[model samples]
Target: MNKFKKSKEIKKIKKIHFMLFFIAFIIFIFLSFQNEEDILKKLDENVTFESIHYTGTLEIIRNNNKIIKTFECWAKNDLFLIIFKNPEDNGVKYLKKDGNLYVYFPSADDVLTISKSMMKQGFMGSDISNEDITRNRKLLDDYSIVSFNKIIEKDNIFYELTLQAKTKDVPYFMQKLIINSDFVAIKTEQYDLAKRLVKTIIVDEIKKFGSRYYPVKVTIQDGIKTSYKTIFSITDVSFNIPIDPKIFTIQNLYNK
Candidate 1:
């Protein structure tokens, strides 16, 4: 009778251990999927817009030298048009449509297609690259979340996400993204294929446009040049506005 009682007690303890392990496993899976979905939703919310119009001012600073450029931008779906308004770059235009980038030089009165090789180069001597302006895709489309966690710092809550590129075609192979509670990207650190940090983007301010929060001021820093940085400020912005389809056409690239 004593032996039977001991055996029963041992079995009961083993069952309890198994149940605890199962519960832990389920919780782990739930959190893993839940966090990924939450991050994806936040990213999509920030980027989604039927159409948008904004006036952007760019301040490029290299060491002690600074240059300012202003432009009017309109974007819808995969199409966007940028027209420089500053005197130095006046009438110069860039149009992105059907996965291709086209530039119109006002002085030459010509439109030229930009090749993929040129996308990595600086845009008009600014720290920002051509790709940076033309890339309209969501980050999750090219990246897989490696890990994510909610962190609190300086009385603000942020979601820190580690992401790895799904393929080698992406410029940044890895990224550490920080998004605030408003679903706005507060900062992003981009890494190369070798896991070396290549660039960083920080959002300085955000404003609400209708129901969405948009970044009004941002700074981009290239890893190769510590002294080089670009500050992009959006002075006027409107989202979900009706835009004419002809505005994004190649023929309209040179039109005012």
Candidate 2:
């Protein structure tokens, strides 16, 4: 009877150990899957613009304070229809369609097409170039999030996300983006192949337009020599406004 009781106690101990191990394995698998699903959901929710249109005046500064240049810009979608109203150059327009970009230079009476090599060049000596404007990649489409953490901004809170490109065509392949909880990208840091800081973009003066928040002022700082800053102050902005597709054509660039 004593031997039988001992045997029964040993079996019970073994069963309990096995059950605990099994439960731990199941819990690990569940947590891993949940984490993956959360990442995909966050990427899907990153960029969600039904439609956007805005007109704003811009000023480009140097060394964070010196006024380098200024311009009045009108943009729709990813296209700049009217540029170079202030400063010097007149009636210059930048058009981007189907991933191809072209510049209409009214001052030179010539239309110069933009090549992939020139994508990094500044637009009219300003901090923002053609790539910065047109290469607005959707997080789900081109990048994979490596990590996400909280960051405190001056007036609000944000998530600092480290992302790496999943494709070769992405211009800013490796970047760290500061995205607000509402999915607004308030800041971005781009790096070059040598892991050097290439550019830093800051969005400020956020104002409520319709039901969404829009940045009325934007500043892009180049980390290289001749630091440039571009400031955009919105005069009028409306989302889902009636815009004809023809307004995005290259022919419309020269149209009065």
Candidate 3:
């Protein structure tokens, strides 16, 4: 009887251990999924603005020369218009609409169409190219979220989102976006078709305006050039305000 009782007790202990392990495993899976979903929600909210109008300073550094120009930009969805305020091209206007880009020259009294090759030249001498601006689409739409990992540095914790492009026509083949706990993008690594790092954008500051989050100051650095970088800072940011649709038309580029 003593031997039988001891055997029964051993079996009961083994069953309890198995149940505890199973419960922990289930909870771990649930938490993992929940965390990823929460991160995606925050990212979507941060980038998708209803409308934005702001004045910004664009600083370009190349070799030993530094050029600074201030501009006002208005954007709604995929369309945007930027009017340079100073430094020789004061009246220059850049407009992007309906999958096309154009530049209006006030001095020449003409509007020039822009293409991919022209976009590669950069936007208003800044590191932000036409391709970069027009990629207004959501990150999840273009790339697949492959991994989610927590990074602990010092006393701060962050989540790193690794993305791989789903299509060949994407501007970046791979990107690693580092976001804070609040889901604000702190930095991104942009890669080319050959899997070469081409550009890195670091968000210096973010401002909250009436429940909307905007990156007020950002630095875009050229990966290959290393020394070349462009700092963009915005002021007087207004969001979700009414804007005339006609203003985005090509004819309106000269008319209004």
lDDT against true structure, model 3: 0.85
- The order by descending lDDT is 1, 3, 2
The per-model lDDT (C-alpha) reads 0.88, 0.68, 0.85
| Top TM-score model | 1
Q: Which runs in model 2 stand beyond 4 Å of their true positions?
A: 1-50, 63-80, 151-157
What does candidate 1's lDDT look like per residue over 9-90, in tens digits? 9999999999999999999999987776677677678778889899999999999999999999999988999899999999
In the range 1-256, model 3's lDDT, one tens digit per residue, is 9999999999999999999999999999888866776787778887788788999899899978899999888889888888888868877888888888889998877899897777667887778877887667777778877888889999788989888899987878999889886678899998988889989999999987767677889999998999899999999988878888777877776763
lDDT (Cα, 0-100) at 161 in candidate 2: 75
CA RMSD of each candidate after superposition: 2.7, 4.7, 4.1
Find the 10 residues in a row with the least total lDDT in model 2: 39-48
Which candidate achieves the best lDDT against the true structure? 1
Candidate 1 lDDT for residue 68: 96
Better of 1 and 2 by TM-score: 1
Clash totals, every prediction: 0, 0, 0
lDDT (Cα, 0-100) at 236 in candidate 3: 90
Cα RMSD of predicted structure 2 = 4.7
Alpha-carbon shift of residue 144 in model 2 (angstroms): 1.3
Q: Compared to the true structure, candidate 2 yields what TM-score?
A: 0.74
